[model samples]
Target: MKLLEIVEQLFAQYGYLVLLIGLPLDAIALPIPPGNTTLTYTGYLAYKGVLHWLPAVLSAYAGAIIGMTVTYWIGYKFGQPLFDRYGERLLLKPVHMERTKQAYQKHGNKLLLFSFLMPGVRQFIGYATGIIRVPFRTFALYAYTGAAIWVFLFTGIGFLFGEQWKHVLIWVEQSLLYITIGLGAALAILVYVKWRKYVLQKKATARAIDR
Candidate 1:
């Protein structure tokens, strides 16, 4: 009847569902607490002998990759028009996109490999990688690597902490809140820097081309 009852039943019977449901929602930026809670709970379930660690890890990685793929497709196919109409109001600067593209271009696979760990950048880096039309095989390779590590890190933390994980969850949430704010500020600074560099480079190139 109530949602809590449903959750209790699910937790009792199928702990993996938490990973399946939570990962995608988090990836979509729904303000759901990060995937760590689902992960840690899964870890606890595994410790209680009701779940398996490998499948839990796989479920997490699969859910995140699939959710991120959807986000990437949405951004690739329709994000540009959406941006054209509302970019200015939302602070979605095109130059930030450009700079991210350039970063991917110069660093190639390295950026994708580490993108998962980077706060505030992780969620968009995958989507932007696809929107910019990075090769699928390459995207899959690096993105999966990142997702695997991401899942393992949280799952391992939960497993190691065992029953004493509530403290970890609280600390993680508070840290993430600070991280979100810091990331917003950092992104703004990055957009400004990227835009200025782009403008200067464009002017120089135009002058050279004219001569």
Candidate 2:
């Protein structure tokens, strides 16, 4: 069966349970139901009066946060050893970790807020944050806020579009490639700007000290 059909069946049989459980699993990177599709479907259901908007949105938000939190803890507790043992097969090296850590430090914790909007990135950000030992409080603040916004965005789309949510999904899937490329270019520019500013500041400070 098609994933959307399966999701429809699940929602029919399980109602809110589908969102509560399915979303968390998706957040953890399981390929069952895509998170955006699920949220959009939930929104459509709300529009159809099959589900309540508040509960549907809440369930999705909670599920995403829980899944990410669990993944983060797993990464914190076991990521290093597993990577040490099996990372070569995955082409993950120590240098990659070091570079990621440096980037995280330079960008600060707020960078995680956008992880959800990036394809294939939401699944890894939680794990990476944990492996890098980011404080849980900071992780929760940004990650949870991002989750809420992401959930609302998709759900609202589904709700507003009614039966046409599928078209939106298709558009999103196609546009994701362009969006990812744009985001990558923007990030590169931001990093370059920050680096340039830092260098200029350091040069000025050095000149002052010499004087």
Candidate 3:
């Protein structure tokens, strides 16, 4: 909770810059200030009129994007060689990397969205995606969207609950897995529906073009 107080203090002093800088650091697997607490506190500040709601959200979103991108590039540049050389000593084998790539391919990138919700995995996912060479466009489509949803959800909780937001974080941490699972299912359904629509539209366009 002292850390939570520290986050509030940082926001109080520097305003939106805290979210802008801290989030990127957090994404890069640095806890310059942790992400979840900072987001909730940002929303709380917004609720208290210390910071503008919309700008706070925007700052957090931008920061998260910057962070994820930085880590992804880091992994893209050096992760393969670094991991390959040291992984076996740590019990990680080539099959594990292959399995990761296969999983990403099978999921068609929706999995990347929810990976942001998971704490440990979230930190490393960008690196993994980069190391495995997920195409930049596909990675951006999912990663950027995921960052928006992630920032809004956590910050919104702070805005909605105000003073009670910290207490709620305890519950959130305990339930994060369930939350992630629920979010994953919802995202999967949404993706399926969108894909179905796209397929139908393509079919219709083809039929018209043929006729």
Clashes per candidate, residues 3 or more apart or on different chains: 0, 0, 0
lDDT of 1: 0.72
Q: Which pairs of residues collide in candidate 2? A: none
Best by TM-score: 2
State the RMSD for candidate 3. 10.2
lDDT by residue for model 3 over 1-211, one digit each (tens)?
5787778678768888998899988988887688888988888888999888888899999999999998889988998998889998999999989987887898848767866678666788898889998998888999999998889889988999988998887788669877777767997899799889999999999999999
Worst 10 residues of 2 by lDDT: 106-115
Q: Per-residue lDDT for 132 in model 1?
A: 71
Task: Please write out the lDDT profile of model 2 over residues 100-198, one tens digit for every residue.
Answer: 888898774666887787788888888889987788998999999999888988899899999899998778766875788887899899989988999
Each candidate structure's TM-score, on Cα atoms with residue i matched to residue i, is 0.67, 0.81, 0.77
Model 1 over residues 41-132: C-alpha lDDT tens digits?
A: 66766776778888878888888787677766776777667767788898878896686677777776776775655556567776677667
The parts of candidate 2 lying over 4 Å away from their true place are 84-96, 108-110, 185-211
Off by over 4 Å in 3: 84-96, 178-211
List the lowest-lDDT window of 10 residues for candidate 1. 2-11
TM-score of 1: 0.67
